[model samples]
Target chain A: MRPIRAKLTQLMIFGVLLSMLAGCSYLNPKPLKPWDRDVLARPEMQLDADSMEDLMDTKIYFSKEASRGGANIGGGGCGCN
Target chain B: MQLKQTGRLGPALAAATCTLLSGQGAQAAETEQVDVTSLQYREVDRVNVDEEVIALKRKGKDEKRFSLKLYHDTITGASPNGAYFPSDTYTSPSGSSYSSTLAPITDERYAVSADWEREDSRRQKTQYGLAYSIELDYDSLGANWSRSRDSQNRMRTYSYGYGFNYDVIHAEGGNPVGLAPATDTTRSNQDNKLLFDFLGGVSQVLNRQGVFQLNYGLSLSNGYLSDPYKFISIDNDAVVDNLLYEKRPDTRLGHSLYARVIYNIDDNVLKGSYRYYIDDWGILSHTLDMRYRYKLNNDFYLQPHFRHYSQRAADFYSIVFYDAPAASTYEYASADYRLGNLDSLTLGLQAGTRIGKRTDLSLRYEILRQTDRLGEFPSLNASILQLSFRYTAK
Candidate 1:
């Protein structure tokens, strides 16, 4: 039963991802031009502008909690866990 | 005189023009940056940590970048040893009385990592990284590789990555036998574990004011999953009868789905993210985070952040065993509160400003609280303070 549920969840996740990709054609009819990217280029708009702070937060949370990973990949290991 | 002027002047003019153009290109594409950060974390009547980090990055004109980071931290104080108190005192089977209390500990850690990335003219980027960390009784080495490509219009990005880690644990004193009594003398000096991680993601630019990303991550770990220093108490008629070292399954598999959105409204930026995590150990969790960067001016901003997390207990997690199982049965059990049902919340604020033409500084503070759903374990409160400085070379 657990294996079946796990498989179903995996399928659902992939299904959602596929639908999102397919819907992109209709959702993004007018893509922004290079000249219109001024706001997007700002430091505040970057996904990981403050890498150090993000690293610290990830480490701290990982030590105190059981659930980890999602934001990025591969940050070695620690005994604190 | 005219011949000499044409011969020398023409070549010199062309050469100077070429040098000027190349210099301008180099200036536009090359960058060097250094960042320093310090953090202090304190848990109410529990652990305290002091950490410092330094990072250096260099980007070349050929779209290649390299970065190195150094980390050091010191941890000290006492933490709950996974024993629960059902009464003021409990008599052991030998007619001895004892009281449960926190366990004192101190440790220091150092870690370093280096990463390199290269991007081609076709908008395909590849990255490689290596990391190592060491402590008094633990050591870890890791490596990772990733690649990403952008769509023709640069409106979408697809990425995938893989990582591997090898770790060795040499517990202080010795590694305790799993599920054995705390007083048992049998022990091993070392144990090891391995981890593998895989990630896939997509990022989309939704118009000029917003962006969205979705990611999926899978992780697998095997061997030595138990904490040697933690133990569980067996309750017998409201008295602590026995204490056994914690035990856990040797393997774990986890999956996570994460989504994030960033939008710019006027001059302010708003960021939000959600994550759903599940594991084979019967633990399921959800996390939600939100941040709003209110721009007071171009040089200064105040950001408020909030995060909430909730999780269900693992299958083998228990506060105390009413009926102790035989050690020969090889049953899996642990009293670690981190594996128990709980909810946590963090509230934080950050203030950042430009200190000089090529430098910036930021300060952040956060408060976190964790509540145990079973109420058998004590609640936890912690505070975090961090300061950072960044300098860019012109």
Candidate 2:
């Protein structure tokens, strides 16, 4: 019973998030200007600008615990095995 | 006089030699960069790991690029045995016993991987990669490919990525049973596990200050998915011994939906992400991670990050083996705390600075705490520290 409820809740949240992502343009439809990209182009502004760091962080977390793949591609293996 | 000049130049020559040996003086074409990172991770009184990684990336004509990575890490100390008993020690059926804390273990891992990517003039990009990692008893080989396309106006981007991993697990010496009787010395066979991950995402440039992406992924793992070293304790009258090997469904299907947005406001960049994950093993998890990078001038930045994670236990997870006489007869059970209900919080800070025209350096520290432990296990706290440097040309 609890598992079912949890799955349902997760599904609902996923649907809501998907819808929100789809409807974002409706809320703010302004197109970015060329000059606005100056800040956006900064290395720190990109979510995965440091791909190596992000991958290592994910790998560490994956080995130390369970649950996987929240970010990019999934890797493999267990350290404790 | 020449000898005196040579002596005077010794310090300069030594400095030059040191710089060259550090790989900082290597010359590259306008389209290459090298990144080096070192990480130290410690789980208070549990495990310690030291890792070193070096990556080289080069760009070619027409936006084509290739990258290679060399990684190695040494891990030492004890890992949880998944056995719990009120007594100080609990013995398993294989004549092996462990304390309430953890089991002693050590392993070394190494991996080498390469990636190639290219983007055409039409804004269509493709990336492919292969990686292999080997440890003492386990080996994994993985391949991944992704393709993305930008909309006509380049305002929206769509991507699809597929990854597959093949792994072999061979226990050192021989595999032992979870709940073997005193007389049983059955050696288990090698186990194989295969995993496939599929991901699709749509990323949109929401104004110049922000970009948002929503990704949905599915992961399917088949074959021997349970930890061979984990055990379940059956404290029932029907079982003479309390230790039993854990058994899990051979197949697991997991789904994850993740959303992320990065917005740059003034000198600060704000990043936020949320993930909802569910699996057939009756585990559901939610993760929220956020970071803020505040630039203090044009050359340095400080980033503070916060992450929260929560998950429910697997259906067969239990601290103690308390099933019916017939069911307790080793159908399926696990005492691994990783599969139990838990919540964790991570707080981190990173500081980085640009040096010279093409060199960058950064240091990061994070502390993590896992609360709401399952069973009688103590809470977990860990810390990680990392330092990284990058040299870019062009």
| DockQ list for all candidates | 0.66, 0.47
lDDT by residue for model 2 (B192-287), tens = 899899988888888877898888888999987777777776665533245666777788888888889998888688899998888878888888
Worst 10 residues of 2 chain A by lDDT: A72-81
TM-score of each: 0.89, 0.86
- In candidate 2, the residue pairs with backbone N, CA or C atoms under 3 Å apart (3 or more residues apart, or in different chains) clash, namely B178-B245, B179-B245
Ten-residue region with minimum lDDT total, candidate 1 chain B: B1-10
Which candidate has the top score in DockQ?
1
Q: Please state the error at residue B311 of candidate 2 in Å.
A: 0.9
Q: Which stretches of candidate 2 lie over 4 Å from their true place?
A: A2-21, A24-28, A33-35, A74-81, B1-30, B87-101, B176-183, B237-241, B326-330, B373-375
Name the 10 consecutive residues with the lowest summed lDDT in model 2 chain B.
B1-10
